[model samples]
Target: IPILMGLFAAGGTIYGMAEESLPFYTLLVPVMMAARFDPVVAAATVLLGAGIGTLGSTINPFATVIAANAAGIPFTDGILLRLAILAIGWLICVAYVMRYARKVRADQSQSIVYDQYESNKKHFLGDHDETQTLAFTTTRKVILGIFAAAFAVMIYGVSSLGWWMAEISAVFLGAAIIIGLIARMSEEEITTSFIDGARDLLGVALIIGIARGIVVIMDKGMITDTILNSAEGMVTGLSSFVFINVMYWLEVLLSFLVPSSSGLAVLTMPIMAPLADFANVGRELVVTAYQSASGVVNLVTPTSGVVMGGLAIARVPYVKWIKWVAPLLGILTIMIMVMLSVGVML
Candidate 1:
């Protein structure tokens, strides 16, 4: 499931697929709970899987393409390097999630959220009988097929057909109606079911909305511009090694304030990219460093709707998530810095 999440994220260039991942928390949380894992495991799998993939985005139009364009280079300039980082970073994330998952599965006491285990189980699993084996009815089989087809079409639409969030939402909404019809649900039942599902996600929706509001406030105050100017001044005359690393860390800090990858790309690349020449580094390395830092920071940045919203859906507390993911973040930061330094030398 984590691998599938990563693969989907690798193709999520249109809007970064942050909110797109929300629905999966409802789907995967119960399944992971049934398998004796906690909600944290499900949340980590989706968050880290997608987060790491976005961090190493090779062809993602939002991060790589936008940054490269702003840096006055072809998007493909450092494709091979990004692809390598994607692969290595994804492996590291998968192994980290699996280790925690295995520990939770083998002994529930090892789960980070063990105290909330019973409540989480009741909240996510509801009254479903764990001992009862559900037969694969034909209706269920068809519903599953439709569910899979909806995602397939979503990916195809986004990657090839220029579909944005509205189009993607339409596809899912249409699928939900069709599935409801196929199941012979009454009109009231379908509407009620939809409302119930939305209610369950109300907290997540508010978190996303509030996070966006914070971004709006920052933009209105021109704080983002001020920070960008400050970052530019800080890295003006450093050597290649120090310059790239400082740029990476600056981006890491900036991503918290401006979580939108494309927005950050447009804001910083032009200013920072030219500075790379003064430091005797290629502009492509600047794009690389920028995207890498953005990717790493977005993994846990609270200002990001994706991070806050995903945790809300998974019933994972923000602080607990930080505790669980801090080590993996440290490891990724080191790997990214090493890669950025090497790119400078090359």
Candidate 2:
């Protein structure tokens, strides 16, 4: 109530992030324990943030709700389909990423001198800290506690309340009450942190603006119609498995532009509904394809506002994330498509 009225926007191509406090900060904060420049930690951070964000994004307006409605399904009814799609996407992503990360380590052969997770575990068991020892004062503990509690509450708020306004609002309010007393912060100083924090998000805000542009442009151009039309033509006389493959490939390519689950479904439904009926493919199966492609494509797309937003928030450059994540995404996409083919045949 004190700040923004709500957290998520209905159709933002980019800035429309969800309100989960736990997952959002969890992905980035692991960095504090990593070596200042460790690539493993960086990769892990990218994976966690983008993965959780997408999973949660299922309920997100653009990613799931709006498109579901447009797809001729009730908004809440698509939740199961979205979950199935997200699971398949994550499975492929994690399997390939683990290998890609190993290759990065194998190729570089650098010592895991500052593995953040390992370091944190050690610290919990009485390991000696070098540089950060002096920095981990009572104030830091209080601030961390505040952040943690705020995150916990906000996570609940997201699953229940379904808006970013409450979560973000909670953060500022918690920070003032907790960090303020611990640091004996003046009202001026606490207010300053809020300003600085919001300012830090300018880059993410910009990316959101661009994502909106892409959705609007693609939608205005009627791209989805062309995609579904092509799918219909390709599978006109194909067998069950081939038909599934045709639609799968179509989605893999379309996902590059229509990363939002809802957007893709909206673009797909008018065409897919008739095609599914014609082919005797169940509506649920067609939904499976939509969900699967939606998850896998965004993981690698440079246009993905969520992925880009994570990088921006972490102060990581876009090219760096893309460079490391591309190979992983490629392998994952292939695996997901192949698996979905098997499922469709069954």
- Tell me how far the alpha carbon of residue 265 in candidate 1 is from the true structure, in angstroms, after superposition: 0.5
The lDDT of each candidate is 0.85, 0.55
* TM-score attained by model 2: 0.69
RMSD of each: 1.6, 7.9
Q: Which candidate number maximizes TM-score?
A: 1
- Estimate, for each residue in 45-117, the C-alpha lDDT of model 2 and write its tens digit: 4444345345334566555555455556655654544455445545544554455445544543332433333
Number of colliding residue pairs in each model: 0, 3
Which candidate leads in lDDT?
Answer: 1
